[model samples]
Target: MLQGKPLLGVTLVITATLLFAINDATNKYLLVSYDVPLVAAIRNIVHAILMIAILGPYQGHRLVQSTRPGLVIIRSVCLTVGTLFAGLALQLMPIAETTAIIYLSPIIVVLLARPILGESIGIVGWLAALGGFAGVVLIARPGGGLDPLGVIFALCNVGATVSYYLLTRILAKSERTLTLLFYSALIGAILFGLAMPWFWFGAMPSNFEIILFLSLGVTAGLGHFCFTAANRYAPASVLAPMTYSHLLWAGILGWLVFGQLPDSWGLAGMLVIAAAGVAVALRTRFARR
Candidate 1:
């Protein structure tokens, strides 16, 4: 709650969002350059390493300490499902589109917060939720004729993301942040590993591919760490919508790396989502102050 920490949290969240967007954009590039199943597998393997080797030094005890074991377990599993599902969505869909759909996570979080977290949101949160949902609809709508499979994956990611944050909210009180990160990574590795056999066609990544895949894990892990801290230091109302900054970052990365940019529709939808989220963030700040 110190001035520096909250400011750090906000900056961390923004930077994390940028890294996360870059992660997706890079993953998309690698997905094109390499095999999906293999890229997915390597990403997990490297990520699992980061969880154990990298995070252990900072906060190792978080993994074993527990106040809500069942909640932690459920949250881990849900995130595993969500992460793998989102990866599959990426394999089927364009990166930019999938990223937009994933923005729906905050809307789901607001909706679920009432029942799960017993948080009372005012009209502003609801309006933001509605606007965010509309953005998803705009992207997924049939007239756009986005690939049906892509839409399915994107929507699945929405659920996966919601489950992730919901569990994060549940764990926020009890679990050490490291423990939460480890669980998500551990579950994602195992769950996705199991599915690997079904989809695995081993096209071993080139040296460059290996680095790219590892960066995926690093970006995600660090990004999530910052993301968690953001919620910890500030209210969700302050931080939740800021997560949507990923879109702006993603659009830039997509163009710079892949020469892909969201069209007019994508820009319009993102603007609506941004406006709605910013409004919610502003309202929350005002109410809290």
Candidate 2:
């Protein structure tokens, strides 16, 4: 049996969050110079290549095998949509606001679980979900420095990610983690590749831009790997709260990279959403206890 290692798990979760934040920042930076689809396609292609190079030696063809192939493909498509939407949102919005909006995925999952997974949410869960939605409105409201289109994209990302998480929960019982990971990368790469030629521009990117695009794949793959590894050491209850650290990283990146800061309302909104998410995570954790 795997040993419980909360400390290691927490460390890994925080590391993964930081890496993901960096990936978002770099992706946003790249979007200033490349079309959304082109950037997304390159990132997914690099991710798929890395997945094969890293997992192929040991897992070989097993990486592609899935007991629930249909669910796996749906999950992959959901992830692809989430990634693309997030990239497009980041292209148009501040990282802090975008990250805060995407954070609503957990709340969305709670609301969705009832109908989809037949899971029950108590009064507190309902309140927490409401609080998260309120926070989203506060952040997206007028004078919040967020573009309307970006808000739409972020909301779409939340929807896609909620679906992705739900599928992950159902598929985890029958699928290998590596297999799921491989399918996500492979499906994203293939789908995005097919769409890239239409969005392709002949302009060559600088060496630095190329490196940033490459780093997106590295950060994405490694961040997910660390998160998966973290869960092996500690239950989701222990790692979920640590994910809030992503907001901190997002704030810092937003300020450092783009010199953009969320207004008072936006900051308050982010805090509320973070608070609600932590409350829900802790409630579920102790409830299981």
Could you give candidate 1's per-residue lDDT for residues 114-159 as a string of tens digits? Answer: 8889987888889889998788777767777577887787778778
Q: Compute the lDDT for candidate 1.
A: 0.74
lDDT top scorer = 2
Candidate 1 RMSD to the correct structure: 2.5
- Measured against the true structure, the TM-scores of the candidates, in listed sequence, are 0.88, 0.97
| CA shift of 199, model 2, Å | 1.8
- In model 1, which runs have C-alpha deviations exceeding 4 angstroms? 1-6, 33-37, 57-61, 229-237
CA-lDDT, candidates in order: 0.74, 0.91
The weakest ten consecutive residues by lDDT in model 2 span: 1-10
Give lDDT for model 2. Answer: 0.91
Residue pairs with clashing backbones, model 1: none
Lowest-lDDT window of 10 residues in candidate 1?
1-10
